[model samples]
Every structure is written in C-alpha cells, then in structure tokens.
Target: MREDTAQEQGLDLEPPVPMEEEKEVMEEMEVEIEDPLPCLSETDTQGIIKGRDLFGYVGIEAVLDQMRRKTMKAGFEFNIMVVGQSGLGKSTLVNTLFKSKVSRKSCTPNYEEKISKTVHLQSVSHIIEEKGVKMKLTVIDTPGFGDQINNENCWEPIVKYVNEQYEKYLKEELNVNRKRRIPDSRVHCCVYFLPATGHWLRPIDVEFMRRLGKIVSIVPVIAKADTLTLEERLEFKQRIRQDLQANGIRVYPQKEYDEDAEDRILNDKIRENIPFAVVGTDKEHQVNGNKVLGRKTKWGIIEVENVAHCEFAHLRDLLIRSHLQDLKDVTHNIHYETYRVKRLNESNANGLALSPLTLENGTLEKSEAESHL
Candidate 1:
C-alpha cells in the first residue's frame, strides 16, 4: 500500500527506459576515443602516419616555436678557414663577409711581423650579435701558404690541422662521459682565394683545393676580380671549371650529395657559376650620395656589395646567406663521416688504436690517413 502510494505520487520505483535508448546509452559509455595520429593500425602496412584533418587545436605547430627558442638560447658556432697566397685580400673579404672588423687586414704590417717561413695555422674569434641571436665566428687564417720559394707540400700542415680536429672530435665521442655539446672546432668551410690571372687553375691551387676538398668544403673565388676585364673573368671561370672537372676535383654542392630535386635546382644554379669572381674591400666609397663598401677606382667605385659591379654578393650569399648551414651539414655528414669511418675501420683492422702522431725530424706529424676514396 505504501509502494503504491509512492508510485501514485509520481516517483517511480525504477526509471523506465526504452529498449533502443537504453542500448544507445550503454554503447556511448563503452566507446573508446582514438588518437588522430595513430602510431599503428591493422590497415597500415608500412606504419606511416598520414596527415588528417584536425578537429580542434592540437598545439603541433608549437614545436617549431620550441625549436626556435632553444636554438636562440643556445646561439650558434661557425668556424671558417681562409687559405690563399699573401696579399690576396683574404682578410678584407672575410671582414666584408661579416660586415664588421672580424678579420684583421692582411695589409697591416703587424700581421706580417712574423715572416711565415712555413705554412702556419692561427685562429681569431669574435662574438657577433644580430637581432638577439649570437654567433661565435672563428676565422682560421693560414699564413705563409705558397709564400716560400719551394711551395711543395705546403698543404701538409693544413691537412694535419684538419685531421687533428677530427681526432679531437673522435676522442670526445669515445669518452665514457662526455659534454652535452662537444665544441665544434672542425673547419666547416675553407675559402680558397685564387688569383685573378685570367688563366686556368694553377698547379698549387689545384693541389691545395683537391686535397682540402676531400677533408673540408672548399669555395674557390677569384680574388681582386676588378683586375680582370668582364670578358676575361667569364673566360677564366669557364677554364677553371673545365680544369676542375678534368682533374676530378670535388667542390661544394657535389651532385652526388644533393638531397632532393629542390636542392638540385638551387645547387645547379650555383654550379653554373662556380669559382665566383669576387672582390673584397672594407672601404666605404660615396656612390650616388650613399656610402658603399667599395674601392674608389678611376672607373667609378667598384661596389663590393653591389651585384652589378662584382660577384661578391653571390659569394657572400652562398657562404653566409643561403648555404651557411648547408656547408656545416656537408662538413659533418660527408667530410667528417669519411674521416670517422676511416679511423674506426683502421683501428679495427689493425687490432689496436693508432697513435695521434708519428715522429718526423723530431717533430710530431699526423699519422697516414686513408685515401679519401
């Protein structure tokens, strides 16, 4: 009688539900939500994640911002080496490259204080900050190169230095406990200054670039290009390329290493204008009421920054603007990989670790490195 009275008062003992509605309520509770980027699936054989339409904000695009923040905080290191004969305006060009006094003038008498009896290696570093990003730029200058009367085997010291860097990196990597980021002192790029002789590649230049090309990224440039006529510059560049091809010298942006069609298209343009005819001057000259870094010649100012006047812009673009990171990549991937593999294979083959150096004339020199095949 009390249950009947409660039911009559509009309170049901059990809330009644329709069969179809009850089944839908149970099904909704049992359903499991899935991720859009499914890692594995019965339908996907190769396990590739295909792009899908996002229903809501997933924050995936924030990864680029995170990477940018980390890189900005860490800054960057770029080490470049300059190799050329004396008085080729190497320092001037390097300074022009950074748009600051990063490189000492080769003309300065203090620089020649030590008459380079042999090819000696030295480095200078500067911290350049641009728009909150700091770049530690180190310029390794090779003086006394080809300065001696007998310039035979002048590249020995440079080779030794490069190998020494590789050895340093290898040792760091082999350490049981290593630094979070090993200091990258390896030569990223070697800008070889070729004299504007309006001629083919010289034997010394060829030899230097060929050997260095294997170990480092080489960017050969015709220095003091203003000295040559426009016609002469074009002919000289053509001849240099021909000689380089005939001699089997590998320069930067090697066709074999092109990453994809985009890289090939961009690098093809650079290859067509290899051995850039470049002039470097840190002097600011008045051109059309504006001061430009250029040389004040009788035939107007040879604007260093002006592409119309010289190809320095092209060289700078390739070096710093367009291919700076690419050069570093090539060094780490191709050049460093070659050195690393050779060293490891030799160590394994010999059944012992090779010493860093062997004595020659009571002076320590780099052990024989495998031929860069």
Candidate 2:
C-alpha cells in the first residue's frame, strides 16, 4: 500500500529507527532522578541503628538507672549487729540472711582472720526488690561478746567505739553540703542476738543490753531456736519476761489497748522493749526436734511461722514500715557528717588547722553555731 494510504489506515510504513537515535529520543523524554529525602536524617538513622544494635545494653542501662534512683530514694544504711556468746553461729546466721560470706577465724589474742585482724567486724549488704519496693539490708557480724581470747572486757570498749564512730559519722559525713548537721545517734539501731538454749537472761547479755539501751533502741533476738521444745520455748519466754520485767521491760502479746496503758506499760520496762514472738524452725538443724541445733525457716528465725505466730515479725514490720523513712533521713544526715569530718581530717592531717595555738578557736570551730555564723 502507498505510504499515504498506510498512514490513514493507522499503520507504519517507515523503516525501524536506529538504535542510538531511539536511545537519544528516550533519554530526551525521560524524567531526571534525584535522591529522595529520607524519613530520618543521617544522624537520626545512625542513632536508630545503634539503638537496635545495643538493645540489650540499653535495657541494662535502663535497669541500672532505675536501681540508682531507688538507691538514692532509699538512702538509709542500717547497721545491725548479731551479738551472743561465741560459737553460737552468728556468722552463719548473717551469711544465710544476707547471702554474703562474713566470717572470721582466730589468729591471735583479740585478732580475727578476715580483711583486717583485731576482732574485725564483718558486714554483708544485699538488695531486696519486691513489689517495686527496693530495700537494702546490711548485717554486721560482731564477735560474740565474751570471747575467751579477746579479753572478757573487750565488749565494753567495742560498744563505746561503735557509739563514737556513729557520733563521728553523724557530725561529719551526714551533712557535707547542708547548712546544719544532725546527731549521729538518730541513725544507728542495735540488735542483741541470744542463744536459743542459754540461760534466759545471762548477766553478760543483760549488762550489754543495759548499756546499749542508754544509746539507741535495742531489739533482742533469740537465736538458734529450733533446738528447744515447745514447752522449753514457752518457759524460756516466761523467764525472759520475768528478767526483763525486773529490769523494767514489759512483755505482752500484740494487742489493741488504751494509749495511756500502753505508754505506762512501755515506760515501766527497763529497755521499754517487749519480747518479739518466739520463733523456731527445723531447717537450720540436722537432727529432729530433740537433737537438731535448729534451722533457718522460710520465716526468718526471728519471724517463725507468720506474723500472727511471731512477735519478732511484728517488731520488724514496725521498724521497716513505720520507721524506715525517718531512719533514711537520719542516716543521710549522719553520713553527711561523717564525710564532712573525714574531709576535715584529711585536710588537717599534716598538722595544719584553721587557727593554731588557740584552744578557743578549736572549740568554736567544732561548734555548729560558730561555723554556721
């Protein structure tokens, strides 16, 4: 067909276009391609990739942050000592509770074989996370007061030093940045551990408790109780009641009563402290009820069975639930004072003072009024 007729009929009569000419035509019609803006910038993209790469580390960091915040919020250091006659398993009891090894061995007179000798005090600290509440429990293992080699009179001096250290911490470390300092005694609490089978109120225990009473609130715990029979336990409780009553302590079951009566009752007691409910368990011991020394129960030895069954649980609850916040505040102040004094000592260790050759200046320097003013 003629080219004009082919065109009218909608057909091509022309030869195939050259390859290079077709490519040029296509290129002329093609749209230019430019790089598209990404959803994230280069920096943001890198961050996202890094976050994906370190998901585990990120999670751990988050947990660490939470723990740090909790530590700051619950900034109280409670130093609890377990005291009793030697060989009563004070070290074992503390190690079991705090889940940390705190032990010592005799090396010389008045010396133990831990980090430092000389009846070195051992302590174990652990954190308990429950129901989102984080708590730190520090247990200090003290030498059983009447050590044969440490000298019978070692107990008094140690107690005095502890009190003095507490005072030093309060006046120095507790308030390094604050304008005022709080007393140290407000932060320390004492626990007296007694053997489950020993004489109800040993003279030594009584004397130590009496002295401790003058300084801080003291809690008495009957240790290694699984060794005693139900009847013996009951009798032991009664004897403790009598002895403490003689010393001005009141023993009573947990119950509701008139405020006036409670106050009067507490005031009448020697330490004004009641015996926590008696606790016993069969786990820490190897023998059956008769010969087994006793065992650590699911309920703390101090809180056997349950709160309803043990007075120590009630006492513990009172201290943990009621006094923990106040204790934290007090302990923070004490640590601040301790830190402050330590810094002062370090600064003055070379025999330099703010003023020399004047006792008046020294006295006034230590006083709150003078320093603050």
Candidate 3:
C-alpha cells in the first residue's frame, strides 16, 4: 500500500535491508555497547603513575643519574658546630669521624695555649673528596664554652654566630644579582657534648640546649663515655632524657618532624636512644689481628666503633650516613626559613628597606649585623 501511494505521488523509495544483514548490524551494536571506549579525563587519573600502567620504557629513572652527575660536579657544603668544654674530646671526635684533622684544634699547633677567656667562635673548613664526590666540611668550634667558673650567657656568642650566618644567606638571597650558588655557612647540626658525670643534665646544659635547639638541630652526646661504667652510662642517659623532657627542650629527630610512617619508626628508635653515650679516640690499637679505633686503658682497650663498648657507631651513622641530607634540609627549610620570615616581618614593621647593609668586603659587618639581632 505504501509503495502504491509513493508511485501515485511520483516518489521513488529504496529497497529494505535483508533480515540477516539487520541481525548482524544489531549484533555489532550490542558488542560496541558491551565494551565501550574509556571516557577518562586528565583530572581523573592525574597522580602517581604505577610501573605497570606505563606502556613501555620511558627512561624517566635516568633523572637520578643526571642529578648525581651534577651534584658530583658541584660539591656541597656542610657546616657543623661542636659545643662543649675544652677537655671533652670535641676535636678528637670530629677528627675521628672524618678520619682527617678537620677541627680547629687539629689545625692549630698550640691550641691549648690559646684558650679564650670567653666563648670564642672559630670555624675551619676543608675540602673532602672520596670516590669521585667532593664535600666542603666546616667544623665550628666554640671554645671557652662552659669552661669558666662564672659561666654567664656563654651561649650568646654562639647564638649570634648562627644568626649571622642566616643574615648573610638572607642578604645574598635578597640581592638582585645573587651568586649562582650562595655559600652556605649556616650551621646544619650542632653537636652538644655533655660531660659523663653519671648525673642529671646540669643547669648550663639545659639552658644552652634550650636556646640553641630552637635555632638549629642539636644532637647531645655523653662526652668521654668510657669514664662511666655500663650501668652508670645507661642510668645517666635516662636521667638526661627525663631532664630534657621536664625542661621542654626539643632535640634532634623531634617527634613532630617525622615525615612518614617509615621515618617515624626509624626515628623513634633513634629517639629512644637519645644522647648517645659515645667515646672518641684518634688512636688505633691491634686487636684480633686487625687495627681498630680505640682507647687503651690498664684493663683492656675500649673500642670506639664497637657498639658493645660505645655508641659512637650509632652517632656516626645518624650524622653522616642516614640523616645527613635531612639535616641540611631542616637547616634550610625549618631553621633558616623561620629566621628569614621573622627578619622580613620585622623589617616590614619598621618600614626599613629590604636591601642588606654591606661593608667594603661585600659582607655585613659583624657589629652592624649583631646590632640588628
């Protein structure tokens, strides 16, 4: 009937599709409907691409090698400040750690003759190279610290020095034409030595650490641990830890700074063993057909690296191997950032210009810088 109507109207119509062809088209449509193409947007799958998600080799891991090469070419700087009295083996420990005479006392022939009446800051820097890598190691020594009978405000000099370094770096950063690599004299870590008296933390110790801990990373250790018995050492460490808590002093590997679960676990172990009871010696003695770094007493030799004898190994691992980079990062990001923000805010409030004052040597004069502080 439709065909007859179309013929009467002078309209031409095409023939209908066969039943089998129609069925095949329907099957194809069903197949497409069952397995549609993905409709993912960039925002949906934007993060954390897994290895299996990659189609083929992309060579993205080569960035590590590139970074290593650059770092090797441009050596980094690490400045460590050692705070203790003269007879605490601070110089000996530093030399023992690096296997080189990098301390101020080591460099000076008559160091004992030149003891300062007040706290004096001296820094000695040396370029250390090993296995195609170079590092500029600077050891800051605080002489006459805690050495005087009337020890009043001995930490003031140390505090001033730390701020001076921060000021220097901040000045360079604020400069319009800054150096490509601003020399980092900022103290990364301050190793505070406590005498192994087998007693609680003294007032001076608590006060010094309390002030310095806020500005830099402080790692307290029992200097000359061999003087105490094993039980005495453990008890002394416990007492010191309790004192640190009661006094509200924050030491390194602080709980709040843990970055992740893994870091927390590792640092928790270190925290439990805080204020490592360490013995330092530059002399080596023959034991078991091999030479070992140790101090010889009348009874036997006390091995410095042996865990059973002393915790120097743990201290070394923490400072050099495990948390070295973290120390640097904390110095720059946490300590220095805090100082920078405070200084900038003060300048803003005072309506002072951001431009740094400079002396003839293109550096801030010590007196002028400390005046601001």
lDDT of 2 at 370: 20
- Of candidate 3, the 10-residue stretch with the lowest lDDT total is 358-367
Location of the lowest summed lDDT over 10 successive residues in candidate 2: 250-259
**Cα misplacement distance, residue 154 of candidate 2 (Å):** 2.8
lDDT of 3 at 272: 86
Clashes of each: 0, 25, 0
RMSD to true structure for each model, in Å: 9.2, 18.7, 6.0
lDDT of 1 by residue, 227-288 (tens): 99989989999999999998989898799989899999999999998888888877887778
lDDT of 3: 0.88
Q: Over 4 Å off in model 3, which ranges?
A: 1-45, 358-373
Q: What is the lDDT of residue 12 in candidate 1?
A: 64
Order by TM-score, highest first: 3, 1, 2
Model 1 scores worst on lDDT over the 10 consecutive residues at 358-367
Q: How close is every model to the real structure, measured as TM-score?
A: 0.83, 0.48, 0.86
C-alpha positional error of residue 355 in candidate 1 after TM-score superposition, expressed in Å: 8.6
**Could you tell me how far off, in angstroms, the CA of residue 31 lies in candidate 1 after the best superposition?**
24
Winner on lDDT between 1 and 2 is 1
